[model samples]
Target: MMADDIISSFPDEILCHILSFLPTKHVVATSVLSKRWKFLWRSLPFFDFHYDGDLFDYDRNNEAYSHFLHSVDSFLLSRDRDEPLHRFRLRSDSTYGHPVSIQRWITPAVSGSVRHLDLCLDWGFVMPSVVFSCKTLVVLKLTFIRVENTFSVDLPLLKILHLNNISSPEGLDLSQLLSGCPNLEDLEVKGFISTTKGKFITLPKLVRASILEDLLPLEVVKDVEVLFLDSKYQQILDFDFQNLVRLELILQLSKDWLGVLEVLEHCPKLQTLLICIYKSSFDTFLAGHEEVVWSYPQSVPACISSHLKTCSLKYYSGSIDEIQFASYIMGNAKYLRIMKICIDSESHFTFGEKLHMERELSSCMKSSDTCTLSFEYSS
Candidate 1:
């Protein structure tokens, strides 16, 4: 009959849904509202717990830290066993020397069959083994953690997995981790450094992947249909992608042009291609290498002759290698519908040189009669 009573009189399921949108701390605090709202948060499917303070200060704030730990324990203890958890997120900058406490907090989420699990901890805490075998998990994200190679993973329904700044021991077998997820589609691994020798990582059903690492392994790129690669390593020409449809590459300008061309020759089904060129401080180091001679391919790749439709070159500087590559694609891409080039602002070429370069590209013998070319200067 009144505004206050309207929300309080909501059905139990609706009240839990509303509380699921709030942070775990705020949801717990709502117990003080009234007797009817006392246990409503216990059935909420989502829980997010974040502690932003320094863990080293636990001695000075022992009472506060103890209270926070007790609150987490109480919250998990109060959850309804019959209700399934949809998402669980816990982030702590410092573990405060109590890895066991963190483990205890996560055990219930795993047992409850949480669909999405996100855990971020600064200290190198060994994750519980139950996480590796979470069959109900659809998404899993871990940050600043270490994964051992001995554990077994059995995530049958997992579709998305993100591992950031993750480290592994000397004998860690990453292939074991990938093989467990049969239906995984999207995977992102950034700042991952393997201490041991390389392992062959395979994902047969993978549709998209982003790998940003110091050493980009060829095995990880083999089966992906769409890939985004940003790496310091330049030895990726040896790998082949037969089913690849789209590719986005971010690389330093000092990369070997011959190697890049070798990679392009391997993709047979590439329909869309984007290359982002960046200026690196190691230009002098790159200059020491032998120059790449402009030798046109005897026969154009199958992708260029039949499949390629959209091609973009960003930060184009009209260098010899850039011009040759662009000209080759323009001349050979029979199905090309759009070819867009963005000139670099800090390019070495003059205004007249740029105009000449554009005219040269426009006059190239295009195999695709309906192909259109567009040029613009980088802002």
Candidate 2:
């Protein structure tokens, strides 16, 4: 007869499904609504526990932290073991300062066959080894966690993996982890701090990947179709990506025109190319790079002549080397459909400088009759 009674009269399975979309804390708080909801949350397939610094009062934060920890333990302990955990997420600010307790909280989810696990922990926390061997995990994301080399990882069904701000006790052997994932499709590794040399081990089914790293040697995976790289490393002469269809390169100040050309010569199938030049100083970094000393290749790469369709250049300053590289692409890319040049808004360029750059790029002889050139200022 009442609205609340009408909604509660629905099937228990439907109510559980509705509660799955809510946070675990809210789901658990519903226990006081009615007798039917008292134990309904225990059978939920999804569990997400997040604790922020402001969630507890500074004066009595310890009591709030203890309650949060106890709530997580009780939730996991009360879960029916036979029911599969569809997803489990835990993000904490280290209020308790106990790493062993975090491991204990994660064990039951793994045993219950959690399909998705997202963990964001404070520093000094090493993930339990049981997570490495989670075969039922379809998606796993870890942030600010240390990965040890001794632990064996065998995520057979993992499809998407994101590791941000990850560290290693010993140098992390990425090859071991990549070899175990047979179905990995999308991978993103960002801000990875390692004492040993970092490597990007390739997998056959990996279609998209992004890596933002320091001056580390990159072993580019040839099988990745779409790749984004933001690196400080200058040694890119050995990069060989034959199957790359789309590429976005965020360059450092150390990268010169020759370095860009060297990478373009290797990607034979690259269709969409986006280059964002990151300038940190007013000094001409590309100067004194012997721009004219190096002989240009006699013929253009196959990708430029046939495969490359769209090319976008961000932070384009009217430098001699940049003009040369842009001219080369416009002159050689026979199949190019659109070429967009985005000028750096931060750089103070005169009206004459902007007009000259636009005229220079517009006059360049394009091999493709259908090619269109446009210019814009970066937003």
Of candidate 2, the 10-residue stretch with the lowest lDDT total is 286-295
For candidate 2, the TM-score is 0.74
RMSD of each: 5.7, 5.1
Q: Mind sharing the TM-score for model 1? A: 0.70
Q: Could you give candidate 2's per-residue lDDT for residues 85-198 as a string of tens digits?
A: 889898988545568888777887787688999999877788776787988999999998887664577899999988898887775656566766888998888877655333
Model 1, 239-357: lDDT tens digits are 67987899888767554555565677888889998888776666546655654557876777788888999999898765667777888888889899999999877666788988998
> For every model in order, what is the number of clashing pairs?
0, 0
Write down the lDDT of every candidate, Cα atoms only.
0.78, 0.79
User: In model 1, what is the error at residue 293, expressed in angstroms?
Assistant: 7.2
lDDT of 1 at 321: 75
